[model samples]
Target: MTILDKYILKRYLITFAVMIMLFVPIGIMANLAEQIGKMIDNEAPVNEILIYYGNFTIYIGSLLFPIFLFLSIIFFTSKLASNTEIVAILSSGVSFARFLRPYLIGASIIAVLMFLMAMFIVPKASAGFNEFKYKYLKRGREDRVTTNIFTQLNETDFIYVSSFNPARKSGNNFTFERFNKDNQLDFKISANMIRWIEKDSTYRLTSYQKRKLRGNREIMETKRRLDTVFNFKIDDLTPVSYVAETKDLFELNQFIEDQKKKGASNINAYKLVKYKRWALPVSAFILTIIAVAVSSIKRRGGMGVNLAFGIFVAFIFIFFDKVFGTLAEQAGFSPLLAVIIPNVFFGVLALYLLQNAKR
Candidate 1:
């Protein structure tokens, strides 16, 4: 549009880029330092290690995207304020709302990019990042799948296991049940041990017993070992940690729907991830407005004061987000509400600050 718009938008984008470049490497180095001992002890290969860090970079960058953008806005806007650039712009017949046009444009660009990354790119990177960590860094730790697993495979069928070993694709004390439309037990199967054969895609059941309930007559069958196909797969038996984080938006929505049908215990956690995919990008707009409003005024203590305030607000936003998210996951609070509440609260604050700054 105007020369003023170009000038401000360029500074905004440049500062945002610079902030990413600075924070991503620092995050990688700090994470590497913490995990280096584990890597060395595990004798991880060089290429794998490099790839892990590469994934880590994307993971951490997406995680901290809002904070970096917030700080970048504060830094440059504070500089513009201190150097009287904003004052000159305002005096030159540019209204405060008009002054914000370039910043909003810049924010829109970042928000769209962040949304794309969150919806598509970050999930793939998160999958690799977590896969490497669990495989190498967490070797010998407890299995990702918990013991005493129970799941409903579908409307009429269910399965249970006393304990499952994901590495071996086997379980002990397995039980499978099927029910009729009237919720009557149609058939029941029990096995002392069950193992999955990957090549054949069948289950090997040892010491298996089956009972058919046929109108007060029980038909019983027993076998020492039998191979049969079940409705469930290994993934149905053992869900990995971070499974929700690994899915893109479309896949995640389908996953939430599937989990809903199965009556999953951790559906709230999955819903939270889904809601946050949208919330994180929308927060970019709110944070940009707040940052410009807060730092556009020249302060007595210069950029340090504005920076401190910006960091404080950012931490508060993160704290509220985590607290509400945990409440939703554990305390049965609404996941959608948990994700939106923090944004609403801060968005109101942003509006308040913007109104005051405009005068």
Candidate 2:
């Protein structure tokens, strides 16, 4: 690379580092302020508190990666424009496309780093961060499951529960049904109360009754208490809120497939997370282009004007992402499409800005 390339790339990376160093501590302090009461009330250890904040840093940083990157690019590029560095570089026989090369290279570096963090580091950190929050701050929150739960466990098996308490690993009004290949009801079990025994990996059913169908006859059995194994686990019945955020890419894909097999109601939420891992990286490129095109020209109000415009665009991008992601999770919109739409929209904006800046 030329001296110009190295100069621009160095500035790009340095500004991004400065942005993270500046914003992340502020984010941590804000989060700590909000949750400090809970931590003290729960009598959390010093070491555990430190660890929770450490994980929180990663979790929050990943969430705000795009905004940090956008602001960093705008900050540096606007300064360059204000100082006439961009004009000088362009006037020195450098084509606009050529001028963008080093910025794209720097963006590619950040994108890869962010992608790796999202795929590996962030998930582990998110798990710890959320675990600490729910354990200490939101006590008894994880124990609550949706009432009147019904789900298909497999092609031939189904389960129902009137109420479930995940903390106690117990539920009431449980029913299990099995169907034959000919679509006939083979058997069914109903229990007044059911509890999972972790040590034995079995379910204990109280006031149990079973009925089996054969040809034109039915057999019935009753028991006060019964212990048996079934295809479903406690997690399959009561998924935690941050379950998707805790899984890395491979684990997340496998989880989605497993949920699909079980006909999980929250499968779309999991699928959204999977799609976003990829979308975030692609958005790095789009945001970078937009930041450059919007800030590379000198303006009357200098860097502030450019920075304000960059922030506006950043907020719009985030708004689109969140709105579409919610639609995907709650309204059955295509997860992939929901994740990609914002990127495509902003990508077109970037191209338009770049074309205008070229002229």
Candidate 3:
């Protein structure tokens, strides 16, 4: 609203925009250079390749937003301090806290953008990006789990498989069971192999056997083959590894609830995706404070010294995020803690640096 707020806010937004514009193409080029050979080998379509880069711009750019914002602030604010603009403003009776108002506004703007992108937009981009990566880029790797698969369709229904072939829509050592309301076994079915008959829309079970409980007696039946239908889909066995990242906010919440009901082993991985979206926006404020604090003081090494410090802090922030994220995904750590720790640590650091800057 004030002249000073407008002036600082304009520079804050412009520098961030410029930083993204400058670096995103560099990222695309670097990615293309690295993955071009793979594209050639796989005979990927031209249109899909173009689309992948577009998604790449959204996905990777959103991932690096905090760093870009941080570095941009340090870069521009360092220059302002170097030119004695900060000193002049302060000498004119502007409080340091008042000077920070515009920076907070800029951070607020970026945070909302990040929240929107992460919750809705980037998920679509992420789905497309990871789909392309797995389809053409990492063809040899299995996108879905293929062995020892288990899923609970409902409170009373459970299924298990020793091994599954997703392409064939078949599995070996298949077993299905259902229980009564009293938790008593109602019936159990086993098969040497089960395959989905696409033309008939039925599941064909080879070497089938079924056992039914009748009060205290067990009745057994066997058959060479049987065709039947079940409520659960084959894809429910093991979805793609990035399944969580592909869902919008509402869908993701519903998905996590479904997975929890089914006793999914990788629920932590899904939770990590949800928690990070919230954490990413909160980080915008923390990073902004730290960036301004570190870069607002004139130094002998000028902007170079401030830039170096910014980069160092940025690296550490990213390092902590990746480490905790990996732990949540692979090591079964708490997803909330993974998102909370890095932000809290950096938040405290920001407060310390802001006090020093004010002094």
Candidate 4:
């Protein structure tokens, strides 16, 4: 690389490294404080807690790096302007856009790293983090837990559980109903309690009742014990207790597919999750541009003012992100649109600001 390239790169690297070191430990400490009590209450061992926090750090660091990189660029580039170094470069016949070459190069590197973290590393780590939380920190397990969870396994059937306990391998107050092509309930099954035998992969239900329709008549009968296994898999039970972020991308994708087949109504939630994983990394690029453009120009008010402005802009970005995401899910906008819409708008804003900065 040229001397100028090496010099600029060195400055950016120093600033980026400092911000990362500062942010990562704070992120770790904040997470540890929030989760440590839960782990202790759950009787988790120290080693397990350590491992959990280590995995959490990887996840947090991956997410925090892009914002830190953006802030670092702003900090150092603003310093260059305040000290008249940029003016010196301009007087030496270097174009402002040409001067941005090193910053863009650094941003490109960060973008690739962010993409890798979002697509591959973060998802895998999330699995471990979530497993630790569910197995150790959560209130109960999927099979031995008590929850009233619902999901559509297909379009025709809506499944419901009034209450289930993993320890008993059973559920109480359960109902599964199927509606006909005309949206009329053709069959319904209500059971007082349902139990599972892991060794045989079957459920032994108690106080079971079946209601059959005969073209305008209803037939209902009750039984004391019924031994049968439903079509649903044991793996399906996990999603009942976990949120979308707790599942990896592949898990989320499979969940949406399974739910769709079962006629699930909440596939949009999974779709939003899938879109968000990539959208978050792409947002780093736009935020980086905005940070660079905003701080590359010197002001009489100095670096502190610039830093405050950056913080405000960051908050605004996050606020809009959540707002638009809610609108996307509740208002029935496309999941892809919900995730990318803010980024698109902010990207244009960044571009306009950069153009004005160049002038």
Candidate 5:
């Protein structure tokens, strides 16, 4: 790399490092202030609190990675433009595309780090962060689905319940069904109530009735109560909402496959987390290009103008991401499409801005 490339890349990395250092503590302090009372009320231990904040750094930082990259790039590049450093480098016959090489290199480095964090590091932090939040901060709040649940256990097995009580480890109007390989109903079990007997490790069903279909006849049986064992756990009836975010890349892939097998109702939500991890690295590149194009030009209003525009764009990008993510989770929108739309839009904007900046 030439001296110019070295100079630009150094500033790119240094400014980003400084930005993270400066802001993360402020974020931690603000969060601590807001949640300190909750922690005290819950009697949270000091060591756990310390570890939670450590995880908080990674969890929150990963979410805001693109925004920080955008703002830092704008801040440093605007300084270069304002001081005529960019002009000096460009005037010496460096092509506009060539001038962008160091910034791209810096972005590539950060992108790889972001990829690692998103796939592996952030998940661990997310697990810790969420565990602490739900355990202490959100005490007594509902953590799992409790009403009108249905799940396909396998190709031939299915289960449903009208309502569940986690504390009681039971459900009302529980029904279990098994089908033949040919998709014929083999047998079905219905119960007025089903409860997990923890001491005995068995499921107790009250007002139980079973009907079995034979080749030429149907067999029926009824009982006041029965004890049985099944392939799934009580918790499996409704997974905690943040389960996807807490899993690493490989684990998440396996989980999605399992959820798909079960015909999970919220499969799109898990799929979104998987797609976003892949998309995040791509976003680093898009945001970097947009930042350079927006800020690496001298303007009458100076750095403030560049920063204001950067903040606006950052908010818009986040808004689109959150909106599309919600649509995928709540509606039946394609998770892959939700991930792609915002990145594709911003990628086009980056190209347009780069062209204008070149001229």
Candidate 6:
């Protein structure tokens, strides 16, 4: 790297580290406050609370890094501008675009890192953290579905699960029912014990009973020793929300496909979530460019004014993010548009400012 590149990189890295350091304490303090109630209510021990808050800060930090990145770029670049160091470099025949080479490289690395964390790392941590919260911090727990729960698979299907011991591969009192599209009773099948057959991805129901309903009278009933293959498994009935966010992207796609097959309604939220998973990572790059473009302009009001303006611009991005997300969920707007609108708008603004900066 050239000396100028190293110089710019040093400033950017220092700003990034400073921003993270400042936010880390704020996050820890906020986590401590949240856990205070949990510690009091559940009488959680110090070590357990410490672990929980530690994970909490990491999770929050992962989400907040993009915002911090935006702030850091503004902080350092504004300093450079106000000090006329950028002017000196321009006068030295260094093109503004050439100076941006290091910044763009740094931004790309951070963006890719953010994408990897959001896609893979955050999911695993979030799963463990959520599990801990459910076990220790939750109050008035709902009885999770287990053995002997009568659950509805869909609008036209009823399942009576007598016993489903998830740990053991055995379940008793299994009944599967399906109705016609017109809501007419089609057929009912009952079984003694159902075992999940993993190799073929099917269910094995042993010692079953079949009843064919015929116009509410004179239905054929038969009993038989049977090993049958069925598509739906015991795990199919798991509440979708119980799944972790990390798994949500893949699962939501599968779910939307399954729902389409089953003719279900209201998958907008899942659609939004899926788009958001990709959108958030790319946002780091766009927001960084926007931050630099906005703050690099020389102003009489100095760094404080530029900092305030940066905060305002960041809030605008965040506000639109929430607003578009809500609209996507409620009105079924194109998830791609909902997620990308802010980036597109900010990209245009960045280009406009950068052109003026070059002039």
lDDT of each: 0.92, 0.89, 0.94, 0.75, 0.94, 0.74
For each candidate in turn, the TM-score is 0.91, 0.93, 0.93, 0.81, 0.95, 0.74
Best by TM-score: 5
How good is model 6 by TM-score? Answer: 0.74
Runs of candidate 2 with Cα error greater than 4 angstroms are 143-145, 152-156, 180-184, 197-207, 223-231
User: Candidate 4: how many backbone clashes?
Assistant: 9
Superposition error at 126 for model 1 (Å): 0.9
TM-score, candidate 2, is: 0.93
Using TM-score as the yardstick, the better of models 1 and 3 is 3
lDDT of prediction 1: 0.92
lDDT for each residue of candidate 6 in 1-359, tens digit (9 for 90 to 100): 99999998888878887999898888788766776787678777678767666667667778788789889999999999998998898889998889788888788777787777766777676766676677667744422345455655677887767665654555788888889998877998888888776776667767777778777675656555566676566565433343436464566577667654443333466566667778776777677777777777789999999889888988898898889987876677887899888778888888887888778
Model 5, runs deviating above 4 Å: 166-168
Q: Write the per-residue lDDT of candidate 4 for residues 21-108, one digit (tens) a residue.
A: 8888888888778877887788888887787777887777875675677678789888988998878887898887787777777777
The residue-by-residue lDDT of candidate 2 on 235-333, one tens digit each, is: 677587568889998999887887787767767888899889988888889999999999999989998998889888878987998899999977999
Task: Give residue 356's error in model 6 in angstroms.
Answer: 2.5
Model 6 segments more than 4 A misplaced: 45-47, 141-176, 179-185, 188-211, 214-244, 248-266
Q: Looking at model 2, which ten-residue stretch has the lowest summed lDDT?
A: 140-149
All candidates in order of TM-score, best leading: 5, 3, 2, 1, 4, 6
Once fitted onto the true fold, the runs of candidate 4 whose alpha carbons sit more than 4 angstroms away are 141-188, 192-204, 211-221, 234-252, 329-333
How high is the lDDT of residue 31 in model 6?
66
* Candidate 5 C-alpha lDDT tens digits along 1-359: 99989999999999998999889989999999999999999999999999999999999888888999999999999999999989998999999999999999999999999999999999999999998998889986646778888888888999999998877889999999999989999999999999999999999999999999999899999999999999989888878878999999999999999988887778899999999999999999999999999998999999999999999999999999999999999899999999999999999999999999999
Candidate numbers sorted by lDDT from highest down:
3, 5, 1, 2, 4, 6
| Candidate 1: tens digits of C-alpha lDDT, residues 135-242 | 789985533555787888899999888888877889999999999999999999999999999999899999999999999899999999999998778778757757
